[model samples]
Target: MTEIWQQSPDGRPLVIDPEGGYHAAFLPRTADAPRPLAAFEPFVTACLAALPEHQREPGARLGLELFLLGAARRFRHAEPLADEELLAGLADLFERHGIARGRLLDLLGELPALERAQATRQVLDEGAATVEEWLASHNQNLTVRVRERLPDWARDLEA
Candidate 1:
């Protein structure tokens, strides 16, 4: 079957099959697309290069998610994102990996963080802590540690 290729608005590759079903395709960066973390491109490239060839696409996508999460938390004061926004970001990543949004939502609904985030929201609503404070407290765990270390690994790739 012949494949028709298009780029999603966020620059992910979309493949349209003869039957008109869409699939995600991991493709090389195009000139017109905005560079993600342009200042850290060298580091990102080196880190991706170190991954096994077959794993590169998924690894790169995960790295992007981590970078976004770290950046969002750092700049939360200037640009606050609701829980839905963070969840939407993960959904976008899953879509880029060829997972349907509905499936992604179903998967996320099963995660422990979903309940924790909701409970935290209730606490915040009760004025027990500000949104930022609640977020910072909850996000300080293993997942955030992993996300924060990703950039460090990327930087280390330059050594």
Candidate 2:
């Protein structure tokens, strides 16, 4: 169950471990391994592309995109990027997907970041003006479960 991943009938890799949870496998890396933000680009792109033209729940689709955005920023292991740079990157990503900066910020403002941060034990900044701020405040907790949820998100989009 642990040594090699078995292929399912649908050709998906499956493995079982004591935790009984899904996992994403990555090659082992040394302590100083470089994990650049670019590493998340393909997954983010594919996740977005998988979304149907007419979503049953547009809000959920937006949430999934937002999560992917935060994941892209959170996964980079080097020195933290500046807030301005991160904000610009976020804006660019959304804009590329046809979501305007103003619209995205409006959605961010509506999210209960403080409550979620408190619930998740992330750094609770009472006023997070943008998604980057919220994500930065919750980076640690956000990164911990990222890989596990990625395939789930893709499946959700396909569904």
Candidate 3:
């Protein structure tokens, strides 16, 4: 059965199958317009690069879920979030997954520009600002600091 994921009114991520019943699962809502798989590649690569060698594979999977949750939240709002609000939501997500906020923030910083832009655009294309543009305009330097700390293993999605 094809399942459609969406955030419910209570802010829970839910899956609805073709029959229109909500399932007990947390699935990120798919974008209204499908994007290339490549749009997600950078997030996957960043997850892999951020995780320690012993937990790389599982970490990547969890990281993708966390990233998608953020995206879904953005899409639900149909607008850009204030930086503090975004970080707080992410912190809650990471806490639920037993990840430290600092570590998750570090990983987020490592995410490539292409992936960040794609995700931001996917949710806020109709808005005047892109994700990068918004960050730039606000002089948000946290993501930039993370970028500077990327390890050699971190791959660029654009490549």
Highest lDDT against the true fold, candidate: 2
lDDT per residue (tens digit) for residues 10-30 in model 2: 233434457755321222234
> Candidate 1, residues 72-159: lDDT per residue as tens digits?
3343443455654444443444455444654444333343353244432332232222223434553333333334444443443222
Model 1 C-alpha RMSD vs. true structure (Å) is 12.2
Stretches of candidate 3 exceeding 4 Å from the true structure:
1-59, 62-73, 113-159
When 2 and 3 are scored with lDDT, the better candidate is 2
* lDDT of candidate model 2 versus the reference: 0.43
All candidates in order of lDDT, best leading: 2, 1, 3
| Deviation of model 3 at 121, angstroms | 11
Candidate 1 clashes: the total is: 0
| TM-score of candidate 1 relative to the true fold | 0.25
lDDT of 2 at 74: 51
Candidate 1 wrongly placed segments (more than 4 Å): 1-79, 113-159
**C-alpha lDDT of candidate 1 relative to the true structure:** 0.40
State the displacement of the C-alpha of residue 122, model 3, in Å, after optimal TM-score superposition.
11
TM-score of each: 0.25, 0.43, 0.31
Error of 3 at 98 (Å): 1.8
**Top of the candidates by TM-score:** 2
